[model samples]
Target: MGDDAPVVERVVESQLAAFNRQALDEFMECYAESVELRIDGVVAASGKEALREIYARQFSVAPVRADVVLRIRQAEWIADHELIEGAAGGPTMSVLALYRVRDGLIDQVQFFGQRVTE
Candidate 1:
């Protein structure tokens, strides 16, 4: 479990970097073929194909160039999984994510996100 922490942290960091760059293909590479992405405690997407569509649409609509302000408030390995708490100010969302990694790929993600309005 201790050894897995560093490896999992790297994977999570890679994914975040890809996402911030809007590199869908690179981001997808870190995920398993049958990946599951839960949003706000709901199964928003499953499988690489579905996830691809979601990201594609998002990237298409996003600004061509923008700064990424995503911040990791806390991160830890628990019960063979990585638990991450973060926030992205652009969307004003508080993020709670649990990642299940296997074979160096992110197999499942349980995400809890909520909009924050000030």
Candidate 2:
């Protein structure tokens, strides 16, 4: 963790807010053009376009309505990035997100998540 931690955390926080609002464009603003994401150890998406496609599909399938609650349980800095863990409820899910932020934007993210039953 270093001074970059704050920048990393801010980007993650903004992105989470965007997710809660179901604002794809704002969500995308946090990422770099060449961003990459790995989901549960699998390389899920590469580049902004792919990211847009993936999230667009997600929102269309299960749009996060106003009632849905997206919460960030923690944001911890380790090395050059921040590890963000959270849950989205109203269909509860747990998520661990590793975000690599560089040059003031999220350059990469590794995500692991599971659906939880209440």
Candidate 3:
């Protein structure tokens, strides 16, 4: 743990705790009310309400659990891989995410790559 551990936890917990119990509302609390979210450089979602709409439309058939702290770098940023375990013992989906934090909240999340089944 470095000097920024508390800040890291603030951001990370806001991210992980929110989604712990299959609660979308909880999952989203990790973000600021005025967050900017982008996926694949195509879809753009700003603000929590808009994100709610976007999240509602996007669904996955796999089980995804957050792996937020694969590595936490400077200024409270973390590079992590989210693992999605699916049925059939088939493949796992892992999404590497980079979160930018401010004041212990996620201001922006830039992530890419489809779920990788490993």
Candidate 4:
């Protein structure tokens, strides 16, 4: 671990913390206005304001949790494997999300996830 390691760690941690709490206002603070968010290969959102709207709506979810693990950051980019425990609108699920950071804001986000099967 080096000095930069701690800084990257904070970026990852802060992102997850705010996301779990649905704090896009705070979360987007570290992002640029041209950010893009992709989930499961679908263009869920683009642009900071638009992305914010996508995430902000999550605030309405009760008991929502996005448990994240294995985060790696290089310069302005941070990649992570995460699980979105809610968003089914009626059912619970876990989804994988990968974020690409530029200028401290999310330049692009890709999510790879599957529903937990019985």
lDDT of 2 by residue, 1-118 (tens): 4666677778877886897677999999998999998987898998999999998887766655322234232334322222222322245455556677778788888866566555
User: lDDT of each structure?
Assistant: 0.65, 0.68, 0.65, 0.67
* After superposition, candidate 2 runs with Cα above 4 Å error: 65-91
Better of 2 and 3 by TM-score: 2
Q: Which candidate should be chosen as best, given TM-score against the real structure?
A: 4
For 1-118, candidate 1 gives per-residue lDDT tens digits of 5667676777777776787688989989988899998876788888989988987887767532222234332334212222222222154554556677777788887766565555
Error of 4 at 7 (Å): 3.7
Question: Of 3 and 4, which scores higher on lDDT?
Answer: 4
- The regions of model 1 sitting more than 4 angstroms off are 63-91
- Which residue pairs show backbone clashes in model 2? none
Residue lDDT tens for model 3, 1-118: 3777778766666666554444677767778888788776655888888877765544233344455436656666776667644423455556667777776678777767574633
Those runs of model 4 whose alpha carbons end farther than 4 Å from true positions after fitting are 1-5, 72-77, 88-92
Which sections of candidate 3 miss by over 4 Å? 1-3, 57-63, 86-91
Query: Candidates' TM-scores?
Result: 0.74, 0.73, 0.71, 0.75
The lowest-lDDT stretch of 10 consecutive residues in candidate 3 is: 56-65
Ranking by TM-score: 4, 1, 2, 3
lDDT score of residue 38 within candidate 3: 76
C-alpha RMSD of each candidate structure in angstroms? 5.7, 5.6, 3.7, 2.8
Q: After best superposition, candidate 4 residue 23: deviation in angstroms?
A: 2.0
Clashes of each: 0, 0, 4, 2
